[model samples]
Target: MAVTKTPIEDVAGDFHRPAEHDGVALWWLGQAGFLLRHNDLRLAVDPYLSDSLAEKYRGTPFPHRRIMAAPVAAGALTELDFVFCTHSHTDHMDPGTLPDMARASPRCRFVVPAAERMKAMERGVPPDRLILVAAGDVVVLSGNFSAAVVPAAHEERWQDGEGHDFFLGYKFRAGEKAVYHSGDCVPFDDLGDWLGVDSIDVALLPVNGRDARRKANGIPGNFHLLEAIALCRNAAIPLLLGHHFGMFDFNTIEVEAARSEIRSLGASSYAELIQPMTRYDIR
Candidate 1:
């Protein structure tokens, strides 16, 4: 199955429209990025919308340029309630992109890992607007919205000893429904044990499995395609959306193949392969 990539301009109107669903609406911004909407509050998670990486790594080992256009321009984005970053990685928490967001949505609070405070500060995020969180922390964003920070294992344990600030996954709740975004985490055997049984309604996970080639380029990978499928099964997630693909041409999974594999395993109904710049209403 070929993926129909939606042009950024085609769906920019969707972002500006008033909240249509009383529940939650999500737009896939490509590569570990999503815009989650609940009521009047709009939250963007792990948005990498700049070509900074391409310029910085032109002569380096990981020199793949961006292959997709941004869904919405930074200056055009307004009324954003919050912006969340899982870690200090360039692709996840971009320096160029964050400043633009701050300029556009002045009131948006940036939620970042506690250890990466300096990164947020260096990116021009002011003291009053920054919210640093670690694993096990629960933050109430608005009246009907809250997030529970879950620690992530990005290749290895996300700890200071591992040279990472603090990698995290965010479990967000809106009204009665709950959604989990596994930000760049590999599936540990005990993934289900920590979160308990059938806790998630929608699960957004990465399918770019780690390999020697990606490792050689000094890039870390997330869950393998099969691992994502198994995690969805074990966690009992009713709606599974796979992301972290189709950004940089150099490092992307064969998404169509993965989608096919999921169907072959008799789990096609559970998996939702959302294209970039497309919207999905979570009812």
Candidate 2:
């Protein structure tokens, strides 16, 4: 089946329109990147709308090449309100993307891990516009839009001496809907407890499972399809939007096969192997 990509030209218009459901609207921007909108607020989580990674790792074993082109450029998100960098990884924080996004959306604030403040700044996130958050902190984006910080184990959880988590995840509350974006995380024993899964309506998770070779090569891993499903079931989350594949050749799964398996599961109403640039609304 041919994949139909939503044109980059239409993205801005799509973001401004009201969602079909009474909840928030979401669009996958590839990898673990997501753009979300609710009411008047527009925000993005871990958006990697650039080719910096590919350029940096061109001849390396990982390569970091993109299988799909970026659906929208960072400079095009002129109305963006907030940008979340779950960590300092190039794909997540994106030096190339963030600087242009900052110049475009002058009022846009960046939500970064407290432990990665210096890293974020080095990647072009302005210090004044930065909203530093630790694991237990909750940031109120607006009257109805807020996010709770949670720890994420990118293979393993680590923290600095100041008790700030080096890796993090975000549980965003938009109106009455709650969406969880777990940034490059594997399933941890206390993950569900930290997420407060009962309140999460949708989970945006990575499905590129980890491996010894990748770990040894410095590429950490995240949840596989089974683990993502298990987390959703255990947490009682109704919807799961799976990502973190198809962006890199070395670290990604066979996406078409994965998508086929997800489709065959007879759970289309709940589970999805997310297509890039497509909009999903949760009610």
Candidate 3:
């Protein structure tokens, strides 16, 4: 049977609904985006809810076409408390999406890498509402919510003069439950060390493996499916939610085939290939 996707119009409504007690409700919004709800707090990470990439790269060699439509419009997410942009990439910190989102969610704050402040500002995040963070920084949102910033090695880790990372990952703690969203990362030597300390319940990782051809075309890649599973096992994270595929046709693997491979390896107990617009509640 085909899995019935929750309507795109209903995604915002679902996000605004109260979550289960002592748990986090997450909805995959295609690519590396997710809407997370805990208690009354509504948050999103790396939301790419626009076709800016497709519009920009229309006539280019790497035409950025979408395999699936955006699950929800950015303007519809009016109840958002915070949005985390892991890097300055257009897809991660969309120019078309952010402006509308900013206008919609008046009090919402955008968390961005300290190194990409200017880029984020250019992408429509107001300066006063931006919370700039570095790799070693911890942002305490409320008594029950907080985030720890960590470096992301997106192909290579780049740093500024003050050593703030250009790319980042976030370990968000909503009460006792923690979720790590590694924004466009490949495994690094100390990645396990960074994540192991957090006692993460669910890891939202990218499984769009890199290649020479894509790299030559200026498309940086992320973790392979096996590497993501290994990271979960090595870090002792109980669940791995794989993403960053099924959005772009050129950079994606066969989703069903990948799922079958995971099942064959007996890693389904801890790993899952996430589907767009589907909700997963972590208790």
Identify the candidate with maximal lDDT. Answer: 3
Residue 175 in model 2: lDDT: 71
Query: Residues 128-219, candidate 3, lDDT per residue (tens digit)?
Result: 99999998788887778888999999988889999999999999888788889999999898887777675888899999999889999899
State in Å the error of residue 212, model 2.
Answer: 0.6
The segments of candidate 3 whose C-alpha lies over 4 angstroms from its true place after superposition are 1-9
- lDDT-better candidate, 1 vs 2: 2
Error of 1 at 139 (Å): 0.9
Best by TM-score: 3
The superposed Cα distance between candidate 3 and the true structure at residue 113, in angstroms, equals 0.3
Measured with C-alpha atoms, the lDDT of residue 131 in candidate 1 is: 94
How many angstroms is residue 35 displaced in model 2 relative to the true structure, after the best TM-score fit?
0.7
Residue pairs with backbone overlap in model 1: none
* Selected candidate, larger TM-score, 2 vs 3: 3
Which lDDT tens digits does candidate 2 get at residues 18-68?
A: 655457778888888889888778899998999999899889887888887
User: What is candidate 1's CA lDDT for residue 71?
Assistant: 75
